[model samples]
Target: MATFIPPGSSNDGADIDLLGKELGLSSGQLREQLNALYARLRLLLTTDELGAWRNESLALFRFSASSSAKATEEYFRVAPRVLDILPPHLFLKWVKRGKALCHDSPGIAAAYFRASPQALATLPERQFNVWLAMGPGLYKRNSESMELAAHFLDAAPALLQVLNLAQLERLLLFLNRLTETDCSLAIRCLDSAYRVFHALEDDERSLFLSIALALVRLKPMASVTFFKQGIDSLAGVTSTQRLRFLTLLAKIAAYNSRHALSFLTDCSHALSGMDRNLHPRLINQCETVLAISAIAGIEFLNNSPAVLASIGPAGLERWYREGLRILRKDEKDGLAYFRLEFPEDGTLERLLVRVELDHVRGVLLMYGEALGGSEIEIRSSDSLADWSLGTIDPGTPATDGTTIFLPSSIDRFDSAEENFTWYKVAVTHQSGHIEFGTFNFCFESKAALFSDSRQLLSADGHGLSDMDRFLGLFDDRRLAADIFSLVEDVRIDYLVQHRYAGIRSGYRFIVQESVWKRPSPVYLPLREAFLEIVIRFSLNGELPFVPEALRGPTDTALRLLQQLRSPEARVEDSAEVAIRLYDLASIIPNTRLPQRDWNAGGSEQARSNRVDTSYRTSDGGDVTIEPGAEVPYQAPTDVDFRGNSNPDMLNIQPTPKDGSDRGTLSPLSSDIGEVQLNSMMQGENLQSGQYTADL
Candidate 1:
C-alpha cells in the first residue's frame, strides 16, 4: 500500500547526507534519527496516511535544513507528537506551512514546530490552518515578531476556552494590527487576553475586543495601557451603566478614537463617588459636548460632578450651554470653560448662587471683631496654616483661637441675602466661642452650675493643655470630647442669643432649620440616639418618643443638657455636664434596639417632664445587655451652625498679650501651640521635652 524508500538507497542517502550536513549531525546519527522517525510515523499513521508522509518527511527535514540545525532538531523533537495529534495530511500541510516560514525566517519555522500538539490540538483542522496563516504575516512584519507569533500559538487553547469564535477573531485581528507597530505589546496583549476575556461576560468580551480594535487603529501606543487598564476602567462603572457607557465610548471611537479610551478613564473616575442615577444624564451631557469637540467633551465629563454639586443640575445645563456657545466662537476659551480653568469672576460666576468668602471677608471680619471685642482674621478653612490644628472640614466654619476660618463659598441657600446671613450666623457662632471664653479653659476652674466630677477622674496634672487634661480623665476620651463639645456649644448659643438681640430671630430660625436635618432618633443605635436627642432638645427644646427601656437614661441625659442652657452657665459647667453625661452614656449599650422597641406602639413612651436631678455614677448594675447586642460606637451627626472647635488646639496657642507681636508665640507654649494633635494622639513617639497628655 505504501512505497517505502530504504534508508541507504542513493536518493534517501543523498537527502540524509544533505540534512546531516545542514543539521551538523554525523552520517550515522542522521540515519538513526531518520529511521526512528519513520518507525514512529508508521506506528502512528495508517497505510493510506503514509502517502503524504513518504514525500513530505524528507521535504520537512530539507525545509528545516534550509533554516538551521536548530530548526532540524526542533522538527525531530516535535514531529512525533504532532503526527500523533494531527492526521498525516494535516501534518503534511503543517510542514508545508513551515517551509513557507523557513523561506523568510528559520527561527520562526523552529518556533512553528515548537507550538506542537498542545496549541494545535485545541482547534479543528480548519481553525488550525487559519492560525498557521497568521504566523507568516506576523513574522514577516518584523524580526522581533518571531517570538510574538510563537506566543500567540502557545496561548491559543486557553483563549479558545474563554472567547467564542467571533470574539477570538476580533482579538486576533487586533493583535495582528498591533504587531505592526509594537511586537512586544502585541505579545503582551495575547498573553493577557485569556484572563481579561475570561472575566468578562460573553457579550462584554465581544464589545471589549471591538473597542480595542477601534482604539489601536488610531493610537497604537495606547494599546499598551488600554489592554492593561481598560477592563478595570469598565469595572468601576455600575453594571446597568456599563452597556450604555461602552456604547458611548464606541460612538466616540467612531469619530474620535484617539481620545475614546481617555474619555472612558476620566468618566469612570468621575462616577466612583457619583450617584448611579446621574450616570445617564452625565452620559447625555458628554454626547452633547462631543457634538462640539471631543477634547471639550472629555474635560466636561470629568468636571460634571463638581459642577453639579456646586450648582445643581439646572446650573450644570446652563453652564454647558454657555460653554457650547463659547466653543462655536473660540474653541480654546470653550475648552477652558469646561475645564474650570477660567477665572471664577468670569461669565461662569454669574450662573452660581454661591456667596464666596472672599466677597464678604471684610464685612464678616468687622462683624466678628465687633462681637468678640477683638481683631479676628477671616480666612478660608481650607487654607489653615497648620494641619496639626486638625482638619477643619473645608466647607464649614471653624476658628483656631485667632483666625476665623470659613469655607470658600456659602452656597447653602438659594438667595444672596440668605447666604450672607448664613455667613453671619457662622461668624456669630465662632465669635461666641472666643467672646464667651469657651477656649479659655482653666484646669483649676470650678463649674458655675453643676457639681465638679473632674477631681475623682483627674490624672495628676499631666497634660499638654487644660482641656486635654480634663478630657483625658474619662475612660473614653473621644466620647467625653464629643459630650463637652455638645454642652459647650449649647452654652455658647444661649450667650450668643441673649447678647445679640438683633441676630436672635435669624439664629433661632437656623436652629429650627437644622432640627429638620438631624437624623431621626428611631433609626440610630441607642447611645448615638441619646446624644442626638440631646442635640435636638438643645436646638428646638422638644423630645421625640423614646423606648420605655431607655426612658430613664434619656430623662437623665435631658437634665444634664438642660443645665447647659442656664444664663450663668460657664465652660466649666459644660465640662461638668459632659462628665455626668459620659457616665450616663457609658452604661448604655451602643447596639441597635429590637424592632419591637421602635415599631410596636406599646413600647413607645413619652419622656417624663420631671426627671431625677440627682447625679448618678457610671456603675449601673441595673442595666442588662443582651447577647451579641454590643456594637462599635458611632458619633452623631454634626450641627451645621456650630462649627467644629477643638479647645485643646485653641489652648495650644498663647493668647496675644496687650501690645506684643503675636507672631512670635512658641508652637508648644501653654494657652497655644501649633501641634500635630491627631498624630500625637495616635501614638507617635514624643520628643523628650514634650508634655504628655493622657488623651
Candidate 2:
C-alpha cells in the first residue's frame, strides 16, 4: 500500500529539500547518527553505502507520517531552484521523476503547487519556452516531460497572449537553429506551431507568416511545408503581404530542381506579379530554374517563349552556350544533341569540313564538287578553287583529246588493274542545248603517268593475249565478234594501259566502238547445230563431222558431255527420233544415194520391187508376182505385139479388112481379143523365175 500525504508533507516528497538542507550541515556532525539509518534505506533502495549516505535525510521521512506533507511542500520550493541550478537538459529529468513517484498522492501534488505557485509557473514556462525556441538538443532526458511542458503551453493562455512579436521572432530563430541541429525535431516543432498559428486571428496570421519566412530562410527543407501552410493560413492578407512568403519559396525552388518546377507551375501567376523591385532576386531564381532544366532535360522554358524572353538575351545566350558546351563534351549524348539542334542535309558535310576532312576521299564523294567537260583541270594541288575546264563538244573525234585533267600532285594517271573506276555523269537540257552538268570520274589504280595511245594499245594487245592464255580458251564468239565489229567500224583514237601484280595478273581494254548495223540473221539454225555439235563433242570426246572445229571448249560443253555420259543419261529408241532424222534428210535437198541398183535382189530392193499381184481364181488363196513375168497368149487385132513380141510367145491374129466377113476371124483370137500381157513373164515359165537380174 502507498502512503498518502498532504501537499506540503515529507513522506510523499522526493526528499530533495532534506538533501539540500543537509548540504548546509557538517559531514562529521551527521555521520555517527546516520550510519544505521543509511544502511536500512540503502537496503530498501538497493544502493550501497555511498548512495545511502547521500540519501540519508530522505530515509527519515519513511518513519514519520507528518513528514510526507513537509517533504511535498519542500519539493515544490526546491524544484524551481534545482531547475535554475541544473542545465536546461537535466531540469526535465527532475520533473518526470517527481511526477512518477508522487502521482498517486494528489494532495502532495496540490501542496507542491500551492506552496510555490510562482516558481512552478515560472520554471516550466521558462524551460519549455526555451526548449520550444532553441529546438530539441542532442539528448532528450525526459521526452514525456517535454511533452507535458508542451501541453502546459496550451493551458497557459496569459503567457501565450503576452508573447510579443519580438518573443515570437526569437522563438522562430530557435526553431531554425533546431532544424540545423535536428531536422526531425524541427519538423515536429514547425508542425505544432503551424497548428497554433492557424488558430490565431487575422493580425496573428500576419505575425506568424513573418516568423515562418524567417525559419524558411534558415532551414528551407524543414520549414518548406510549414511555410506553405502559413501562406494558406493568410486568408485575409493582401498579395503584398505575401511577398516575403513568395521570396522564401523561390529560395527553396532555387535549391531544389523539382521544387523549382513545382513552385513555378503552382505559383505561376503569383510569380509573374512578383515585385519588379525584386528583379535581381527574380533573375537569380530564373538562373537556377534554367540550370536545373538544362541538367534534368526538362523542357520548362520551351513552350513559354515569354518566360524565356523574360530571362533576357544575355541569360538565354549563356544558357545556350553552356548547353552546347555540354553537348560537345559528352561523346554519346553530344552527337545526339547536335543532331537534334541542327538537322539539315549538309550539316554532316559542314561538320566534316570543320574536322579538316576536305581531302578525304569518302568526304569528297559525299560532299565535294564534281568534274565536268572534256577536261576537269585542277589548278593547284591543295584547294578546290584552283581549277579550270576544257570543252567536250560532241560529234567531234576524240583523238589526242584531253578527257580529264586533275592536279599534278593528285597523280592523274591511274592503272586499270588495282581498282575499278567509278564515274558519275549527270546530264541536263537547257534551252536548245544539251549540257552535261557535272561528271565525276574516280579511278583507283597503281600507275602514276599517262602514256601515248598507240603505245598503250600495243601494251594492251599483249595483255589481252596474256588474258586469253590465262583464261585457257577464248570461246566467247559473241564477244570476239563484237571486238571485230568494233575494229572494223571505229577508228583508233587513244588508249591507256594500266597494270598491277598481286595474287593474279589483271588488265582492261578501253575501245571506242562506232555504233553501226551489220547483216545478222534474225533466226539461225547454225546456233542450234553449233550447240548440238558442242554438246556431242563434250559428251563423246569428238564432234560431229559438220561442226568439229567451229565450236570450242566451254563449261556448257563440258557440263553437257558429263550429263550425257552420266548413269542417269536418257536413252531413246523412239520412232520420233528416226522420223526426225528422216525429216532432216528430206529437207536437205542435196541428199544423194550410193551407186547401187535399188531394184536388185537385195532385201531393200526386194521390198521395193516385189508387187502384191493377187489372182483370186474364185478361191480364197491369193498369189503374188514379181515385176517381170511371161505367159502364153493369143493377140487380138487391136493388140499390136508384132514388133515388140517375145520370141517365146506367138501371137496368132488375122487383120480384118473392111469388106471381109467377120465370120472368117478365128474364135481363139476373138475370144482373147486385145489381150495385153507381160512379155518378160511369158518367156519364163508361168510359175516363178528371175527376169532382170543385171538391171
Candidate 3:
C-alpha cells in the first residue's frame, strides 16, 4: 500500500481525515470514534450477511462533511444507530435528505440526523421517506418553523403510539398548510400534537387527523383550536358515535370549512345533554341542512338539543322542515331560525304543539314574582336534577328555595293552551313552596295543629340537616321520607288551591289526570294500597273505595293529612303528620290484597288480608304475616305536578361565596347549624355538589 494505507482506506481514510479536521480531532481520536461506529455497524451487517455494504454505507458519511462541525458530528454520532435499522440504500437516501436540509438550515440538519434513529425505528421505509421529505419543506414554508420541525422529528416514537404513519403524514401536511396563515400556532400544534393525539383512542386518531387537515386547508386559523378544544369536543361524544361525528365534521368542512370545527364542538356538546339515541337522527337532520347552507347547518346543530328539548323529540322533524323551508326561501332568516332567533311572526316557533319554557319563561317569571313578592328566577327542572346528588325526578317541577324550576316543555295535552296551563300549574305549585315556606323547617319548632313526634325519637347524631335529623328518627328512612314528601305536597297544593283561584281549575285538571294514572289500589299490596289511597286523596280529595278491614287505618291517615290544610300549617306540621302516617303504615302487613272482584263491591279474602295482623320495625324487626307472601314495600308512582322533594339534600352547604356577580349567595344560617338553605332556595352552586346551568 505505497504508504501502508489500510484496505479501501484510500477513500475512507481521506474522508475520516477530513471529518477529523472538521471535528477538531486528530486522526487517531477520529479513528477511535469511527472504529466504534464501524464495529456497531459490522455486527448488524454480519448478522444479516450483508457485510459488503459496510464500506458503501461508510462512504455516505462524506455527505455531511460540508455541513457545520456540529452537524457533521451529529451525523456520525447517530450514523450507526440509524443504519442499524435502515438498509444501506435507505441510509444513503436518508443521508442525502439530511444533506438537502443542511443547505437551508444546518441546525435543522443536525436535529434531523440526531432524531433519525427514532423516526426510522418508529415508521416503515415508505413513511420514513415521506417524513424525511417534510423537514426541508417545513423550514422553507416559514423560516421560523425549523425549530418546530426539529421537535416533530424528535417526537416520532411517542407520536407513533397514537397515530399511524398515514395520520402523521396528514398532520404534517396540515401543519405545513397552517404555517402560511399563523406560523406560531402551527408550531404550537406540532409541539402539542403528541400529547393531544395520545388522549384519543387508536381508531379516532386518524379521523381526527383528517379533520385537522381539512380545517387547516379551508380555515387555517381554527387549526390551533382544533388541537385544543377539539379534543375536549371529542370527549362529549361517545366512542361509537365519534366516527359519524368526525365524518360529519369533514362533510361540513367541504362546504363551509370555516365553521367545521364549531359544528364539531357545538354538536358534541349538544349530544352530551341529550339522549344518545338521538345522535344519529340529529346527524341526519344537520346533514339535511348542510346540503342547503353550511353556516345554517352548523347553527342548526349548535342549538339542536335546545330545540329538541323545547319542542320535544316529536317536534324535531317539524322544526327541521320549517327551517328548511326558510332556508330555501331566504338563507338569512333560515340562519336565524336555526339559531332560534327567528322573528316573533316566524312559523318555526309555531311548528310544535307544545309550550316551550323559553316562550313562557317571562310570563311565569312575572307570575312567580307576583306570588312570591320577590325576584324569582324560572329554570328547567332538568337543571337542578343535573346538579343534584340525590335523584331528582325528571319531567317534574321543583324549587331550590329562590328559583321555580319547571319542565322544559309541557305537552301532556294536545293544544298549546293546555300545555301552557300545565306550565302555569307547575309554576304556581313551585312558587307556593317559596311563598308558603316548604323549606323553612325548624326541628325545634312545634306543629301548628298535630302533636310533634320528632322529639320522642332518638337522635342518631349523623344528621347534617334538620330534615335529615327529623327523618333519621324512624327505622325506615325511605318510608319516613316518602311520608314527609306526601304531607308537604299536600300542604303546598292546599295553599296553592286557595291562594291562586285562577289556577284552581288547571290544578284540579292535573290532579284528576294524575288520579286517572294512579294504579288501582285493588291490585296493590295492603301497605302500599294504604299509601296510594292517601296520595289519591291528597291529589283531588276524592278517596277510592277501600276494603272494609283497612278503612279505619286509611281514615286515620287521611285525617292526619287533613291537618296540613290549616293556614297556619308549617313544614314542621308536615313532619308531624308524617310520623303518624308512618306509624299507621308500619302496622299493616305488606301482603298483596286478595283480588277484589271489581264487579262485586267486596271480597271476604281481601277484607281478611287487609286487617292489621303485624308490625315491622324500621330496624329490620320481624313481623307476623298474613296468609299471602309479604312483598317488598314499594313507593307509590310519582305525581306529575308535585315534581320531586329532597329536603335532606338542601341541608348540604353551598360553594364558598366569592365577591362576584355570578349571583352567588351567602350560606343561609340555620338555627342548629350554618346550612346553605338560601343557596338551595336561590338555585346557586352547592359545596357538596356542583351545578352547571348549561346542562
Candidate 4:
C-alpha cells in the first residue's frame, strides 16, 4: 500500500481552525462549508493528502473573490487533487498567480480558476503563469482566441512525464522570450509547443528550447519561423544519437548565447536532408568537437551526414575523432581545419581515403542472401535509438528473423577490404541464426547430441519457451550467453567460410584480425588471460601466446570449444562448453594488473606491454594504450546466432510453425541513394525564407 501523506496539514480539526480565523466565519458555519468541500474531494485524495492541502487551501482564501466560500467549495474540489500532485508552496504560489491572472479578463475568470490547478500541475508555477498572463494582454489588443489562450495548459498534463518541471519552465520561457513583441507569433508557438514536445525526445526538446532561448536573446524573429519548423528537422536523426547531438548544439548556445541560435538553426537546416538509416554507423562522435568551439561542432554537423552517407559511420568517426585531437591542441587551427577555412586541414584529401558505403553494401547483401538463401536487406540498427531512450552499445546487432541489422560503419579496421570483411562476418553470423533453428528449442525433449541437459529444469514445468529452459541450466546466464555466442558464432563462421569459397579471404581476414588486434595475453591475470585465449581459439587461432601458468586451463577450455565446431554439434554441445567455461572462469580471480603480487609478471611493465592497443569503441574508433599500462579484457558484443543473449528470457516465444514467417523477407537492395542535389535544394529553400509566413 502506498503512503498518501499530503503536504503540510496535521489533521481535519487544524484545517477548520485555520479557515475560521482567515475567513471570519463562525466555527459552525466554517465546519459546514469545509464539510461540503471534503465530500467532493474524498474521491481524489486520501485523508493524509487533505491534511497537506490545508495551508495551500488557506492561502487561496487570501485572494479577494466575491463569492469566496462558494467558489472555494466548488473549485477547491478539483484543487484537492492538486494537493496530491504538487508541493504545498508551489500550489499556494499557483493559486495566487491564477488570482492575479483573473483580474486581466473578468469574463472568463471563473473558467481560469477552474482550470488553473491542473495547468499548474503540468508545468512549473512560474512558466504556467508566464504564458497565461500573455492571453489577456493579447485580448486587449483584439487578438483572436484570447479567451481560449489558456488552452495551452491542457497540453501540460501529457508533457509532465516527458519533460520534467525544470525543462517545462525553460520551454515556456523560450516561447515567451521569442514571442514577447508580437502577440500573434506568441499565440502560434503556444499552440504548436505541445505537438512539438510530443514528437521529440526529452533531450531533443531541450536542444530546441535552448537554441530558442539563445535566439530570442540575440535577435527577435521576424516571425517564429525556426520555432515552427525546427521539430520537423529532427525526423532524420536516430533517437539513440539525438540527445548527444542536441546537447552539443546546446553547448554552442552556451558558448556564445547571441549568435549560436542562428548558427545551430543553419546547421540543422543542412541535417534535414540525409538518408539517416543506411551507410551507416549511427554514431554521434562529432559532438565532442562542439566543446572546442561552436564553429567546429556546427561545421561537422553540416558536413558529417553526407560524409557519413558516403563512407558510412566508420570513416566519419575517424575523421571526427582525429579532428578532435587537433581541436584539443590548438583551438584556432582545429577550428580553421574543420570549417575548411584553411587548406592544410587536409579535410578534402582525407575524405579521398574513406571507404564508401557503396563499396561494401553489395558484398554484404550477397553474403547474407547466400546464407539465408532469401533476399535479406542489411538494415542499419539505428532504430534501436527510438526503441530505448537509454544508452546501448552501437556494436550490438539483432535480427527480427528477416532483416539482419548491422552497424552502418565498418571503420574498425584501417584497410577498406578488412572493413568490408568485418561487415561480411557480422551479416553472415546473423543470417546463420535464421538459417539454423536456434529459436526452436524444446524444453523437455532429450538433446539430439548431448545427454542429461533436460534435468536442469523442474520435472513438472510451467509453460516456458525452449530458449528459457535451455539457458536455465546455467547459474551465471550472462557469462553463459557470451560463451554460447562465441561458440555458436564460430560454428556459423566455419559454415559460411566452407560454403562460400568466394568470401573465404574476407572471412579469414576478420578472424585473423580478431587475433592480431586483440590485447596481448601477457598483460592479463591468470583467468582473464585464459578467457582471452578461449576467444582467440574460437576465432581459429591455435593457442596463440598463452602464458605458461594458464596454459592448463586454456587447454581445457580449448578441448570443449573445439567440440562445438563439429558438423554434428547441437545447442547442447554449446551449452556444455558454456558451463565448463563458466566453472573455469569462476575459479580464475578477476584480478586487475596493479593488484599486489600480480601473476602476469613480477614487474608491472612486463604485463603492461601486452596492454590492448586496439581498444574497441562504440563509435567504430579505438583507444590507444599508453606505455606501461595493462588494459583490462573487455568483451565485444557479438551477434548471438542462437537468440540466447537477450535478457528477457521468460518472454521468449516459440518460432512460427510455418517457415514463411521464420525470417523477415527483404527485397534485393539496402542501398543508401544520396546525391548532393538534395542538400543543395534544402539549402536554397532555407535561404529563401520559404518557411516564414505572415501571421
Candidate 5:
C-alpha cells in the first residue's frame, strides 16, 4: 500500500504539495487568486455593486480558461461570485464545470468543496436545489457538507444515511427554517426530497426515515406534524378570527372531509365545557358551517338531526306570526271604497264595504227611497213596512233604491207629553208591478211636537250648515238677493198665511218631461235647485206671497206662479225659488193663523161697525150719521162730481110711496123687454077692475 499511493487521497502526515503538483501552480498563486475572488465577491455582495462584480467575474473566468485543469477550480471560485451577482443564466455553466472537474482532481475538488456550500447557501433556494441535483461535481466536492444538508438531500437522499444525529439535526433545522418562511416552498423541497428518497436502497432509505421521524418527534417544527399544533394554537383567538379559521377549515374539509371533520370536532370539543363567554363565537361558527354546508350542497347537513334541532319550533312560529301581523296591518290601511253603477242583476254583494257608504245611503237601507220607482220593504222584529216610490218624469230610472222607512199611516196620537216611535225599513227593488227583493234593513224614528226651541233649531247641525257654507262662494248679488227674498216670502206664506198645514216644508225641484223635449230626457237646469234654494233662503228667509189687500195674497201669489209657469221660467228660476222657499219654510217660525179658523168670516160687530163708519172719518173722531128708519137716496146727475168733492153741495130728494128710490135704478130692470109690458097691458085691459092691487 505504501508502494503506490493515490496522490489526492488524504494521507496521514503526508505533505506532497498537491496544489503545485496537480495544477502546475504554486499554492500561494491559487490561494491568492481564490482570496482575491472571495474578496471581490464579498465586496460585491455586501455593497450590492453589480458593475464591479461583473468585471471581476469576467476577469476570473478569463484566468481559468488559460489553465486546462483549473476549470473545476475556476467554477468553484466563480460560482460564489455568480451567486453574488445573481446571474441565473450562468448557473448551468458553473454546474457543468463542477460536474466535469468533480472527478479525479482532488485539489480542484477540494477547492470546490470549500466554496460550494457557501455558494449554494448564497444562491436562491430554487436554483440552488436545481444545481445540486444536476451538478454531481458540486455535490461530491462538498460531500461532507452535502451529507449534513437537508437541501442536498432533496437531490440525493441515499447519502442521508451517512449523516449522523448532529448532521440530521442540522438538516432538519435548515428544512424547518426554509419552511418557516414559506410552506409551499417547503412542500416543493419535501416533494423533491421524496423522489430522491425513493431512488435510494431500502436499507439506506429506512435509516433516513428513522432519523427524520426522530427529528420530527424531538422538534415538530421541522416536520409536517406541526400543522396540527398550529391549528390547536389558533383555538384561543377571537370570534372573527375563529370564523376565518373555520372558513379555512371548511375549504380544507372540501378537499379532505376526514381531516376537516376531525379538526372541526376538535374545535367544537375545545369550545364546549370551556368559558361561557365563547358561546356567541361558537354559535357564529356553527352558523358559518351551516351556510357553507348549504352552499356546498352537503347532504349531511340537510339530513342532519343536529342542524334541524338548532333552529327550533318556537323560532319558526315567531317568524310566521310576525309576517301575518304585517299582512293584516297592510289590509286594514289599504282598504278603499268607490261609487259604481248597479249591475244588470242589480246586486252589489261583492263590492268593497267601506267605499260604498254614499251608494249605501243613496240606494241602500240607511236612507229611504225618497225618489225612484224602487221600493223598500223593512222587516223588523215587530212589523214590516213598504214605501211606495215615485220619480220625476224626466229623471233617471229610480231603479237605484235607498232603504229608509216611512210610516204607512203617520198617526198623530194626542199625548200631553212627547212620544217617540221608531219604524224599520228594508230596502228592496221593484220593477213594474213585481217586487225584486229586500236588500237591507234600517230604522226611522219619529218625535212628537217639539215644545222647546232648541229641538226645532237643532237643524243648525248636520249637512245644512255645510250647504250654507257652499252657497257663500257665489258672488252674484242679484241672485243672492233674490234667493233671500224668495226664501223669506215662502216662510211668510207657509207659516203666516195658514197654507200647507201639517206638512213638513222642504224644497225640491224636478225637471219635467215637457221642458226638455228635444233630447227626450230630462236635462239638469242651468242651475241646481238645491243650490238655488240655498241661495234664495239664505237671502230672504221666506218665499214670496201676495197680500190680502190685493184680492187676497193667494191671488197675487197665483199670478206670480203663473208668470213662472213657462218652461224656462219654471225650470230655471221658479224651481230655484221653490226650493229656497221650501228650505226657508222649514227653518222660519209659522206666523199664520190656525188652520181651523183660517177661512172663517169676520164677526157681526165688525160688519156693523164697517157700515156705520164714514169713509172719510178722521183718525180720532167719530162720524155722526143720523139713521132714518129707511133713508131715501138720490143719484147725482152730470154735476161733474168727479172733480174735487164739495161738502156744501147737498141735493136732497123726497121719498116715493114704494119706499124704493126711482133714481137709484136696479141693474135687473135695465134688461127688461117691452114685450113683457104689452102682455101686462092686455091683461090689464081685461081686468081693469081686477087691478085693484098693483101686481
Candidate 6:
C-alpha cells in the first residue's frame, strides 16, 4: 500500500521518507514530525500556499532534535505572520543557520519567526533574519514586557522609509551589540526616528544613524540620554548640521554621559532660530571646542547657539578660534570663558557683534512705506519662497504690493546706519515698482509717449490678456521680460529720484554703483552688449565704450527716453518706452560679439563705468554728472537687475482660518469701570465685612 500523505503539502511520501533516513528517524517518527508541521500551517494557509510552505518547512531536516517540530508548531499558531518573515525561498538557508541557535535555545528560532513580524511588517528576507536572531536578545536584561517590546518592533517599516534595508540592519545590530543592550533606546528610535528622518535626506540618514550608534557604544551608559531627550533633539537638527551635535555628544560622553542630552538639547534649542547655511560653521566651532578639552568643548557647545546668533557666524568663528589663546594660557580659564561663567576680562564682550534683525527693520520699513505709498510690511527675502510668483532671484528686492522683502541682514555694510541706507535702496526699488505700476503694462495697449507701430504678429482680437499678447511676440520670453524691466526700472528710478528727496543719495549711489560694475561692453555677446548700452544710456549711466554697430538704436532709444524727464510722463509713458526698447532688442541676435584682442580694453571699462547722468540737484540747481570723490562699491549689472528680478506679484496673504471680518479693529473692551481703593488701613477688607471710613 502507498504511504499516507498529509492534508496540506503536495510533497510526496518519498520526500518525508528521505528526510527520515537523513535524520536517522523511523518512518513512524518522521511521519509524526511531518504531521505536526502540517497541522500548524493548515490552520493559516490555503492549500495552494501550503505547497510553498512544505518546501520551506524542510529546514526541519537540519534539526535531528525531537522538539524542533513541536516548538515550531506551537510558535506558528501565535505568529500568523511567520510566512511573511521567512519567505518560502529563503527558509532553507535561514534554517541551516539556525542550527547553533536552536542548539543553545531549543525553541528560540521559532519564537523569533513568530514574534518578530507582529510588530514590523515583513522585511526583505535577509533583514528579517538579522532581526529574527536579534529580537529575542534585545530585551534580555531590560524591564520591557513582551507586548511593549513588540510595540517597538512594529515601528521598523515606517522608519525604513527614511533608512534603507542595510541601514535598518545596522541600527538593530548596534542595540544588540551593546553589552547591556538598552531596549529603551530602541523604543526612542521608534518614537522620533520618523521625525529625525523628516529632517534628513535619504542619503544623509545613514551617516546620522552611524553617529548615533557610535555614541551608543562609545558611551554605552548614555542610553538614559538616548531614551530621554537625545532623539527628540536629533529630530530638530538637520543631517548636515548634525556634526556639531555629534562632536558635542562625544565630548559629553567623555566628560560624563549624564550631561550629553542636556548639552544636545541646549544646542538644538539654539539652532532652532538659525539658518541652515550656518551649520557648517557650528560644526567647525564644535571641533575647536573638542580640540581644547572635554570640559571646554562641552561648555562651548552648550552656549554655541546663542553666541552664534549674537556674534554672527564669522564673528563666532573668530571667537571660537581665538579660544585657543586662552586655552594655551590656561585651559581652565578658557573653559570658564566659553561657558560664560567668567567674562574672560572683557574678551567675550570684545568678540561679540550685536546685530539685530530689528536694527534696520523700522528704517527700511518707513523708507519703503513712504515710496510704496502704503504702510508696507518689511519682511526678509526668505519670505519670497512662500509666494507662488515665478522664479525667485537673490539680491533683487521683491514686493507683494503690501510687503517689501529685503535680505535678512545687512552685514554687507559696516555701520547700522550704512546698512539701513543699503536696505533703503532695496526697499525703494521694490516699492517703486508698486508706486509706478511697472507691472501694469498690457499687450496691444497704446503707449502715451511713443506710438505702438509694431505689427501684431498674431490674431489681434484673440482673448489674450495684454500681458499674454505682449509676451507672445518674443521668441525669448526671458529676454523680452528683461528689456521691459530695464525700461520700467529707469522710469521708476526717475520718479523716485524726483519724488523722494530723502532716498535720492542711496538711489543715485546704487544706480551709479551698478553702472560702475557693469560687465565690459565688448565681452558681452553682440545683441546683449547693445541691450547693455541702451540700458546704461537709460540710466544716464556712463559706459567704457559703446560698440559702433549699436550706436544708432542706442542713440534713438536714449533720445526717446529723455522725453520721460518731462513732468507729463506717466506710467503709461514708461510702457511706451518699454515697447520701443523691446522693438530695438527684437532685432539683435543672441550670440557673443566676434572681435580680436578683447582683453586690452578691460581697464577702459573700469574707468568709464559711471557716465555723466544729467542729475537734477536737490535744490533746483543745474543738472550735472560731474565726477566726485570716489566711493567704490559694486552693484549687480543691469541685466542682473532686470533678468533676475522676481516676478510681478499677486496678493499672497494666507486665507484667514476663521474668516473673520478684517474691516474693523478688534474690540478692546465692552465694559469700562474703575475700583475705588479703601485707604482706611493696611489690612482692611472692602467687602467681606463692614469697614469704617476715615472721617
**Candidate 4: tens digits of C-alpha lDDT, residues 478-529:** 6556666666666666665565555566566666755655664555655566
Error of 1 at 647 (Å): 3.1
Poorest 10 consecutive residues by lDDT, candidate 1: 686-695
Candidate number achieving the greatest lDDT relative to the actual structure: 1
Please report, as a residue range, the 10-residue window in candidate 3 with the lowest summed lDDT.
665-674
Q: Candidate 5 on 1-695: residue-level lDDT in tens?
A: 11333323464123223322433444465655544554444333322343333444344444444544454355545555555544434544454444444443334533553455444554454555453433232233343333323234333323334433344344445355544345444444454554444343444433434433443444434334323233343344343344444454445444444444444444444444344343343444334443433222122221122322332222222222332343345432211100111224322222111111221222222112221233333222112111122211211112222222222221111110100011101121111101211111001112122122223323333443222322332343234434433432232223311221211211111111111111100111112222222322222232221111111222223333334333222112332443333343222222222233222233222222222112222233443222323212111111110111111111112232357533431222223234432332222212223222221
Error of 1 at 425 (Å): 0.9
Residue-wise C-alpha lDDT for candidate 6, range 221-336, written one tens digit per residue: 56535644555676656665565566556555554555665566766766666666555656566666666676676577667767666666545665676775787689888887
Expressed as tens digits, the lDDT of each residue in 78-166 for candidate 2 is: 54445444443444444443443334332333333332333334444445444332212222334443333333333333333445445
For candidate 5, the lDDT comes to: 0.31
Q: In model 1, what lDDT does residue 593 have?
A: 77
> Top TM-score: which candidate number?
1
Q: Which pairs in model 3 have colliding backbones?
A: 400-680, 400-681, 401-681, 402-681, 402-682, 654-687, 655-687
Error of 5 at 667 (Å): 85
User: How far in Å is the alpha carbon of 51 misplaced in model 1?
Assistant: 70
After best superposition, candidate 4 residue 48: deviation in angstroms?
A: 24
lDDT of 1 by residue, 98-172 (tens): 766666666777777776566677667667667677555666456677787767655666777887655777777
Quality of model 3 by C-alpha lDDT:
0.69
Worst 10 residues of 2 by lDDT: 425-434
lDDT of each: 0.70, 0.30, 0.69, 0.54, 0.31, 0.54
TM-scores of the candidates in the order shown: 0.47, 0.18, 0.45, 0.44, 0.17, 0.45
Candidate 6 runs further than 4 Å off? 1-70, 74-89, 96-100, 115-162, 180-205, 235-262, 273-301, 304-337, 341-695
